[model samples]
Target chain A: MNFLSRLFGKKNIMTDITIIGTGNMARGLAARAIAGGNSVQILAHGDKAKADALAAEFTGQVSTGVLGDAVTGSIVIPAVYFDAAKEIVARYGDGLDGKVYVDITNPVDFSTFEGLSVPAGSSAAEELQKATGAKVVKAFNTTFAATLGEGQVAGQKLDVLVAGDDEAAVAAVAAFASAAGLTPIVVGPLRRARQLEQTGFLNILLSANEQLPQFQWNSALSFVPAA
Target chain B: MNFLSRLFGKKNIMTDITIIGTGNMARGLAARAIAGGNSVQILAHGDKAKADALAAEFTGQVSTGVLGDAVTGSIVIPAVYFDAAKEIVARYGDGLDGKVYVDITNPVDFSTFEGLSVPAGSSAAEELQKATGAKVVKAFNTTFAATLGEGQVAGQKLDVLVAGDDEAAVAAVAAFASAAGLTPIVVGPLRRARQLEQTGFLNILLSANEQLPQFQWNSALSFVPAA
Candidate 1:
């Protein structure tokens, strides 16, 4: 059966995911969405061709459109950089109300990688939540794009550390993650995004260190329970 | 054999560890030091009785002294709070030069538990390194006091993430951690301490979270490698 046929043939669709941007994260998340049996909508910021190319790569129930178009999915993932994610959130405004906005951007000051770009005590996810009425959930920030494509690091399942204030919003994201064959560890409320962002920054630092070859970008930040 | 006899009777002492502070972390680290067969010295800021009491618990080659007194061990662990640690370092001055200083304080702002108390581009360990000429190493910040006492979380060995600019200093700290029955994952240079401190803050936030019962004070910030 074709990807579209499989998507539409389902009696009850779990959730439709709208991914913004045409970058690696956008592609990675889109792949996971398709694998999880969810319809995906790819939105390009300015270049429609880029979105079209990304959409063409997948045969599932996927569509492409410009950024300003109406979002058609219950879960909107702004898989863009931190600044672009902010702009998308602001532009969506009240249209995103009640929507689960999945924020995967790590607001790291890449110039130094010594600290994050967000203000003290705040995170990109929390700031995005403030800019819009959408229930912003922090997920996939720690999962490198390359690793996300494989859907697992090493042999263990990818652990998606999720944090958000709204229980239903967090649950919605968690449901999608579980369906994608990832372990969803719901850390705490939305405020926990602060640490989640820091953890992402720490992981990035480890990946960039030339001395620690084993901690390349592909390593997973896992919570191994005692045997 | 008694703790002291075992500590000094050996041809070579594994490591002489001097821990400052009478708090839970002090006791926890002292317990690990004794368990690792290292001679320990307990230093109290104002209360000699507290240090004496902690020393009395360990029948090893343990001693007690005030903060300004000469540090007796080759490796000194500042197990006090962040501010107190800074003060202790300043008071010790050049006396700490050439010594291996282990910084276990997580410079967190408990007011919000949202960010660190240190500056944007720095950490408690880095700041301590700058204050004194001692080779400062970041360790045990991610390990909770309770977990340090047990040396493991959920049966898995505690992963002690170490960061220091000096290679030998980092190795010394790593050796102590290994002898104490913990896995020492040396992350990178001293700058990596920034991320380490942030990770500590993040872990603290999770522990303080009321909703996440599983992430109590005893939980660990672990990096589970692929099986």
Candidate 2:
């Protein structure tokens, strides 16, 4: 079921992005990557069928492989949960070095639904950066997977809040977002991911809130820039 | 120099809102309250002239007084910093009991510019609520004072995120926000203020960022609702 674009023994076609996991986020981000004229490689969680199914839906625009197979994209995104994201980094290890690793996970502590699961003053992106030399950039964490398909909420473009210490990495993510027809708002260093996660958490809370019927999972925390 | 609304012996006309401090926030919020058809009272910090000057700008639409004077509004907003907000609550004591006290402070730890100045689990609103019997509602903290004047960002209505344990207090703040030509997004109980504070802090960081010139102080962290 693992359909290799090039022969396993031959040089594979490099992709603009490698998305780990075959979930909604994976599908959503892959859509954006394709729309942005960027090729994608899907590294599914051992479910070759699921990966193949999604790849077929994308009209064979993406290369499909299992998680352990070599990641063939310059930009790697684990469209998985925070814990799983950490595991992916550990699995890839030094292989991710010099690659743009985008951390879109919001580590929410659902135990109390009180705060984030990450430790104080640090963010998921920063922690993921610690696991490898990957240029970790925090983007799309503030954006819901549902909204990424349309690339907007309401009539406004989705504000992709990017945070990373690596300038090249941040710019790379921003370029992709802009190419996808989304507005990328660079929110300073990786530490700012702490705030971005909170912003995302607040959005989730509002969406899940029965009291706030207006705010849904598809809502966008759009930063309306001054004219 | 305390320009009492009425003499110490006479009955004063109660206002719909009382705002402490004559800073930018005070002026901005006063604009909203008046636009909403709500009368305001300004309680300045021993600066009767400053209070009088602002009250004059409102063209006698608001009453003026120095701090320690009796609060006359059903809803009182301390349009001051986090530290000064606590001081105002302490100065008022049980007099604020049964009133709607709105906490609009972010409490950022400027020394590190890292996380919030508040403790790990608590927020400015929750802390302020504990200090007084006043029903503390968190609103306008996520909004910059500059936007209140025009009441919109990029032609969209300003989103007022309100949070509080007291449904009545929360409702009251929402009502005010709605009347002021803004969208009042109730983001759950006062506990959610923790995230709201983080949201506000993030907005501040984005604004102060010299690199992201688009995200200025006049910009907005708008939660664009799903259609």
Deviation of model 2 at B151, angstroms: 1.1
Best by DockQ: 2
Best by TM-score: 2
Query: Chain A TM-score for each candidate, in the given order?
Result: 0.91, 0.94
Per model, the share of native interface contacts recovered reads 0.45, 0.94
* Each candidate's clash count: 3, 0
The CAPRI quality class of candidate 1 comes to: acceptable
**What are the candidates' C-alpha RMSDs?**
4.5, 2.6
- Alpha carbon lDDT of each predicted model: 0.83, 0.87
Off by over 4 Å in 1: A1-15, A44-60, A65-68, A90-97, A154-157, A187-191, A224-227, B1-15, B34-37, B45-61
lDDT for each residue of candidate 1 in A135-193, tens digit (9 for 90 to 100): 98999998888677778876778889899999999999999999998988888778778
